[model samples]
Target: MKVTTTLIAAALACGASFAEAQAVQYAGGKTTFDGKCVVCHQAGGKGMDGLAPPLVEYPGKYAGTDEGRRHLGHTVLYGMFGPIKVKDKSYNFKMPSFASMSDAEIAEVLNYVVFDLNAQHGSAKPFDAEQIKALRASPVDGSAVHAQRESVVKSLGL
Candidate 1:
């Protein structure tokens, strides 16, 4: 009976720690978004005209499938520049890289974005930490030549 009690206590402690960690991660993400993305994406993520694209709906260009999620994660970490099309409109804007952000923080911010935006846009799936990490590890050129915004939009049927 004593051994069983000890095991139960350990399990509870572990669960509590896990929950705490999750809470911290979420809070960190919220903070990061507020500091960075909120300015352009806006508090509601509606985005600023001529400056940022609305994140209300998953850009037909980047959401839903794994490939879409990977593209978005890479874009967020490395940034995108030059002319890009979203919702059938083209904008020549610069998106700076957040490469200095820690993996955990990037994951957290991404999770927050995916979950919150998906809810707003009625998406069934959301990007998670693991997905973000995998995308971050993949090779992406954060260069002007690699922007390929028009082609990507065309491929996505945007």
Candidate 2:
């Protein structure tokens, strides 16, 4: 009985730690988004007219599948410029590179975006730093935004 009780206590403690860590991460993400992405994506991820694409319901545009996630991460780390389509709407704007940010912070911001959008639109799978790192390592120049989008679409069989 004592052993079982000890095990339960340990589990509870670990769970609490995990929850605390997640809370911290979420807070960091919120801060990063406000500092960086909010200029265009807006505080609510709704974006600005004729300036940036809305991040709400963006999972439908960039997270419904594996290919979408890859594309979105690449776009985020390297930035995107020129013309692209989101939710069948064309957006010709510049997204500045956030390469200055640490991979963990990038991940946190992405998690916040994904979680917020998913909650709004009912999607699954939030992106993380590892995925962002891989995309960043690849050869994606923001200048060639359309090419990257085409590649992602091809990969998605879209």
Candidate 3:
């Protein structure tokens, strides 16, 4: 009976640990990423070759600035097409929009990419739902987002 009780306690402890981990700061964003982004961005945001750009570096850099931050929101909501360069490599693909998702969800997913996946630790604030809502008011197609990339890149000096 004691052995069985100890095993149960161990299981309970592990369960609690898992729950705590899930409740971390970026948990909401991580959940959104796992569902929507992992397929393309892949695990740990490493991205795919000749396809999606690895998000690990740029996202962190983007979160630091206003234009870049806005670009992040636009990219997710509008998606992007055509060729883009990241880490000196070229990626040409069509990213699908997630416009149907709520503003809060988009913000959460961006936060996941910028802070959690990219590990951007600094004064850059977590994106708010209202900011995303504001961006949502002006909806554009993926091409527009792609076109806007040059300006944003210039602003970020990337």
- The C-alpha lDDT values of all candidates are 0.66, 0.73, 0.86
Cα lDDT tens digits for candidate 2, 23-134? 5436778889889889888876887777798877654445767767766676777788887666567778889888878888887887777775445434546667777777
Model 1's TM-score against the true structure: 0.66
lDDT of 1: 0.66
Candidate with the greatest lDDT versus the true structure: 3
Q: In candidate 1, how many Å is residue 57 off?
A: 0.9
Give the runs in model 2 whose Cα sits over 4 Å from its true position.
Answer: 1-25, 120-123, 150-158
Q: Which wins on TM-score, candidate 1 or candidate 2?
A: 2
lDDT, residue 76, candidate 3: 91
Tell me, by TM-score, which candidate is best.
3
lDDT of 1 by residue, 39-152 (tens): 877875677777777666664335655556666777778887766555666566577888788777787777666665445424425456676677667657655323544445
Question: Ten consecutive residues with minimal summed lDDT in candidate 1?
Answer: 144-153
Q: In candidate 3, how many clashes are counted?
A: 0
Ranking by TM-score: 3, 2, 1
State TM-scores per candidate. Answer: 0.66, 0.70, 0.83
Cα RMSD (Å) between model 1 and the true structure?
10.4
lDDT (10s digit) by residue, model 3, range 43-157:
8799899998898888788778887888899999989899999868999989999888899999998887887777654667899899999998988888888888878877778
Better of 1 and 3 by TM-score: 3
